[model samples]
Target: MSRTTPAPWRREPGLVGRTVEAFLSPLQDAYLRDTPSAVARLAQLRRGAGKAPEEVPELYGLTGTEGLYAQGPFADEKTEQRATVAVHTAVTLYALHQQSQRSRRMHRTGYELGAAVRMLMPSGEIDEPLRRRFVRVGTATSEAIRADRLRELVLLLRRQEVPLDYAFLADQLAQVQVPQLAPRVRQQWGRGFHAWRPPKATDSDGGGSKGTDTSRDAG
Candidate 1:
C-alpha cells in the first residue's frame, strides 16, 4: 500500500492559543496584585467545580469595576480585559460542559445561575445582613418572574380591584413603589383624591351611615 500523506499542519490553534494567552496574560499579573481574593475565589471555584472554568455573570458584574481599575498596557484595557475573561471563561466552561453536566444545566437556568454566582462571592465583601437581604430579594424576584406575578399585578391594577383608599394607596405606592396595585385601588384613589370627593358616601341602608365616626376617642 502506498504511504499515506500526513495531514497539513494548521496554524489556527497556535494563533488562537496565542491570542488568548496574550489577552489573559495581563490579568494573571494584575489579579496577582490588586485582588488576590478574587483570584483565589476564581481558582477555588474552578477547583471545587472540578470542571472547565465558567465565568459567573453575577461575579463578573460585581468584579468588573475592580478589574477595570487594574488594567495594564492597553488603551481599551477595560473592554479588552472583560472580553478576554469572557472568552477564556467560555472556553473553560465548554471544555467542562460534558464533565459537569449538572452544573452546565443549572448555569443555563437564570435563577440557578444567579444562585451559583452568589455562592462564589467573598463573605467579607458582603456582610451577613446584606447577604441575607440579597438572597431574599433575589429569591422573590426569581419566583415572581417564574410565576408571572408581575404581569398578573399589572392586569389587576388595570381592572381597579385594589382596595386601598386613595391617600393610603398613594402613600403606600410612594413608599413601596407597588406599581402593580389593582386598578380598583388606583381608580378609587385617583377619583377621590383628584376630585376632592369625601370618602364614597357609605350605604345608608343601615349597613353603614355616611359621616358616622367609628373610632372611639382615647381618654
Candidate 2:
C-alpha cells in the first residue's frame, strides 16, 4: 500500500501468491477507505479461517481465486488442494490482521512472518518465548496444526500492530505443504528470523547508527 513499494501482485512470482494478492489487495484498499461492503467481506473471510470450504460455503466465490483453476487441472489433486488452502489461509489471516484497524496498513509489501514477529520484541531484543512459538509454527507437521499455530502467531502480530506480506506468506504456506519444498520454506523462515534487525536510528545531526544486535541464541 505504500507509494514507494510495488503492488502486491508484481512482487509475487507464483500463481498461488499472485492469486492471494489479487484477492486481498482490493479488499484491503476498500476497507482502509471505510467501505462497508469490504469490511463485511473481510469479516466473512475471517470466519472461514481454519475452517473447511464445506463448513463455510458462503466464502467460495469471495476469495477472487477463480484464476487458480481456470487455467486447467493441476498435475495432481494434492497440489491443487495445497494451493487452495494456501490462498485461503493467507487471505483469512489477512482479514483477521486488518480487523479493527483503519489507519495503518496491515498488508505491507515486504514484511514476512519472521520479520513481523521480530518487531514484537521489546527494543528489538528477541524473547525466548516468542522464539519458541515461532519454532513450533515452523515444525508443525499437519495443516491443521500449522493453521492453528499460524492463527496464534497472526493474533500476536495483530496485537502488536505488525504488518505482513500475505503474498510471500501464501507462497510459503503452499510450498511447505510439499515434501521436498518444506525444508526450503523452513530455512527461509529461519533466515528471516535471524537476519531481522531494527531500522537504523537517525542521530540529531543526521548521522545514522545501527540498531541493537539481536543475533543472540534464544536459549
Candidate 3:
C-alpha cells in the first residue's frame, strides 16, 4: 500500500482557527495550572463555611465553595492572565466599532459621480441592511472616487483622537467599488457580510428582475 502526503488544507489549520486556538490556549493553561490550588481553596472555603466533612464533595461538586475561592487569593495568580484576555477582547471590539464608524462616515461624505454610479450599480453582492443604515445615517452620495471626502472623514475621526488608519478607509472604498474583491481579500468581511449585495430596482410591473439587479432596496 502507498501512503499519500497530507494536503496543505489538511496539514495547516486556517488562520481564524489558529487565532481562536491561540486566544483560548492561555485560558486553558491557566485553568489546568490552577486546578490543584482551586481544589485546595475550595476545601478551605467549605470548611470555613461550616459544611460537615461528609457534606464536602469532589472539586467539581464544590460549586458554592469553589466559586467563593475563585473570588479570593485563589484568583490572584490568574488575574494577570484574565486581564490580558480581557484587554485583547476589548481592543478587538473597539477596533471593529471604529472601523464601522469610519465606513459609515465615508458613505456619508458621498462619492464622486463615477464612484457613485459604480456603488449604486454594484456588479457584486451588497449588504442591503448595511446600505440602508448608511443611507439613513446621511452617508448616501451620488459621486465616486471621493478620496478627498474619505480623507476629510479620516481627519475628523483623527481629530477626535481615535487611532484609525486612512488606508483602512481607502480599502473600504475599494470594497464599495468591487465588493466581489472583498472575499478574496478579507476573510472576516467575507464571512460576516456573506449575504450582503447591492439593492435591486424593480420594474413598474412589480416583478423582480432576473439578473444581479434582482435585489431591492432594504428600505
Candidate 4:
C-alpha cells in the first residue's frame, strides 16, 4: 500500500508560504519561467508588481512578507486541507481584489486571479465553509470592480493564455452559479490554453502558457 504524503502546511509556522511557493515552483517553471515571452511577462511583473500595501490581508503574504500564512496546531486532515486551500484561494482572490481597488494598472489582476482560483478548485465545486468564503471573496471582488470597471477585467482575460481547456471550469462556474461567465471566459482563453499534456504538480517542458502576475499584491 502506498503512503499518503503529508501536506506542506503540516509543518513549522515559518515554512508555510515557502511550501506553497515550492508547490507552485513547478507550475512557475512550466507556465512562466520556461519561455522567453512568458519569462518576459514574469520579469515585467516581478519588476513592477510593487511592494505590499498598508493593511492588506495576510493571504497575499506570499509575494511581499512571507511566513504570514503560518498557523499552528492543525488537528487533522480536514483542517490541514482547508488551511491549504484557503491559503491558495485567499491569496489568489485577495491579490486581485486589492489590486482592482487600487488602480487600472491592476486591471489584469482580476483576470489572472480568477484564473488561478479556478485552476485551484476541486471539481467545478468546492464544499462547505470554504465555498462560503470563496463566494464571499468573489462577491467582495465583484463589488470592488463594479460595472464600470468590468470591461477592464474582460480585456485582461482576453490577454491570458490560460492552460485550462475543458468543460471542468464551465461546469464549476455553473456549479457555483456565478452568472454564466465561464463560457465567455473559456472563449477568451481559447484553444491555445490547452496544453498537450494535462496540468499536474510538476510542469512539463511542452509549449503552452497560462500567464499571471498573481503574486506581489500581499497585505
Candidate 5:
C-alpha cells in the first residue's frame, strides 16, 4: 500500500501568494465598503486586462510594489515582470467578476478557476462547451491569450454568481509564466476540475441550502 502525498495547497502559501493576499485583500475590502478609489481602480484594472502593463499606464500605481516585495525583491527584472503580469491579470479578472455586483463579494478565498467553472454546471456534470473553454485557457500559447480566455470564463462565472480566489489565482498565474512551472499549474487546475461535486440537497427540508461555501481547498 502507498500513502498519498499531500497536495501543494496543504502547505502554507509562498511569498508570491502572500503578496497577492496582502495587496488584493485591502482592495477587495475597500470595494466591498464602496470606496471611491477602489471603484476607480477596479475600472482601470478591468480595462488593463489581457493587455501589457506598458500599455496600461494607469495601472502603474495600483500594482502595489510594496506588497510584491513584501518578502523581499525578486532576483531579476524578468521574474519581477512575470509576477507583475500575474498580479495584474488576477486583479483585472477579479474586477470583471465584481462588475455591477457591488453588494456581493466575487473574490472568495480558496475557489480555484477550474472549480469555479465546474460550479457553473447545473448538474455538476461535464458540459462540452464549457470544458472546451477551459481547455483553451490552459492551452493558450501566450499569457495574453490565456488572460483573454480567462476573462471569457470569468464572464460565465459572473452569470452564475460564482466566485474565485484571486490570491491563489495570482500565484498560479505567476507560475504559468515559467515554462517548467506551467505544467504544475495546469495539473493543479485539472485536479480542481475533477474533484468538484455538486452541492447535495438537504434531507431535512428537501431543499437546497443558499449562500453556501463551494470551494475545495486543494491543489
Candidate 6:
C-alpha cells in the first residue's frame, strides 16, 4: 500500500500558493496609486482617527494592481511560489472592496468593483467560493487559488503590506489596459484585511529574568 505524502501547507515554511487574477478589465489604471506628494495633496482624504497618512498610498496603485498574474509557466516550483504574492495581493484588493461595501460607504462605485479571491489547495480540488464563481465565469483554473487546509492566507500578509504599494503593481497595470468599468476587476487584497493578532504578552516584568538567591549554601 502507498502512504499519502504530507500536504505542503502542513509543513513549516512561508505561505505558498498561486495568484489567480481576481478581476480583469480592458481599460487599466482607473484608480490612482498614492504617492508621497499625492498623499499629502489629498489632505482632504484623512486617515482614520490616529492612523498615519502614509499607510494609504496612491489610490491608483491600489486599484490598478488587480488582475496581475505573477510571471509565466507556473510549472516550476519557484515560479509558482513567487506568483503567490499576486494571490496575496488579490486577497488585499478583495478585502478592501468587501469592507468598503460592508460599511455601506461610497468610496468608489458600489464597493469599487469588488472582485473576489480565496486560498486553496494546490490540486485545485477544493470547492471554494472563488472556484464556484470561476466555473460560472469560465475562467481557467490553472492559476486559480483555493482554500488552504491550514491557516488563513490573509493572516500571513502584514496588515500594512499593500501589494499595490510596490512598483510591480504599476508595471502590471501598464501592460494591460483595463477599460473603464469593463466589469473591471479588484479584491480584498489590501491593508487591514484581517483582524490584527491579539495584543502580545506584555514584557513588563516586575523582576529580572535572572533572580538572586538570598539563601546561604548548605554547610
**For candidate 2, what is the total of clashing residue pairs?**
0
| RMSD versus native structure for model 1 | 27.1
1-219: candidate 4 lDDT, tens digit per residue: 001111111222223344434433332443322555433333332321212222234324443223323445567665344333333332232233222221212211122223433433343454454334333434433322222132233233323322221112212222222345534533433321121122333233233322222222111
Candidate 1 C-alpha lDDT tens digits along 1-219: 001111122112222233333333343334435456535544533321212113244334322223323434446654444333433342232222212221111111111112222222332243454344433322332222312222232222223211111112112222122335334333432333222211244533333221222221110
Question: Candidate 3: lDDT of 129?
Answer: 47
Candidate 4, TM-score vs. the true structure? 0.21
Per-residue C-alpha lDDT of model 2 across residues 1-219, encoded as one tens digit per residue:
111112222243488988887777777888989999998999889997765555677888887667687678899989999998888888888888889988767776667677666667765566999889999989987876787788888888887666777888888999999999999888877776666665554423232222232221100
Model 2 gets an lDDT of 0.73
lDDT of residue 110 for candidate 2 = 65
- Give me the runs in candidate 4 sitting further than 4 Å from their true place: 1-15, 34-74, 90-219
* TM-score computed on alpha carbons, candidate 2: 0.84
Q: Give the per-residue lDDT of model 6 (tens digit) for 101-189.
A: 21111111111111112222222234465344433322222222222210132222212121122122312222122234112222212
lDDT values, one for every candidate: 0.28, 0.73, 0.28, 0.30, 0.73, 0.25
Overall local distance difference test of candidate 5: 0.73
Candidate 1 backbone collisions, by pair: 157-182, 157-183, 160-183, 160-184, 161-184, 166-189
The per-prediction tally of clashing pairs is: 6, 0, 19, 3, 0, 37
lDDT of 4 at 125: 56
Candidate 3's displacement at residue 190, Å, is 14
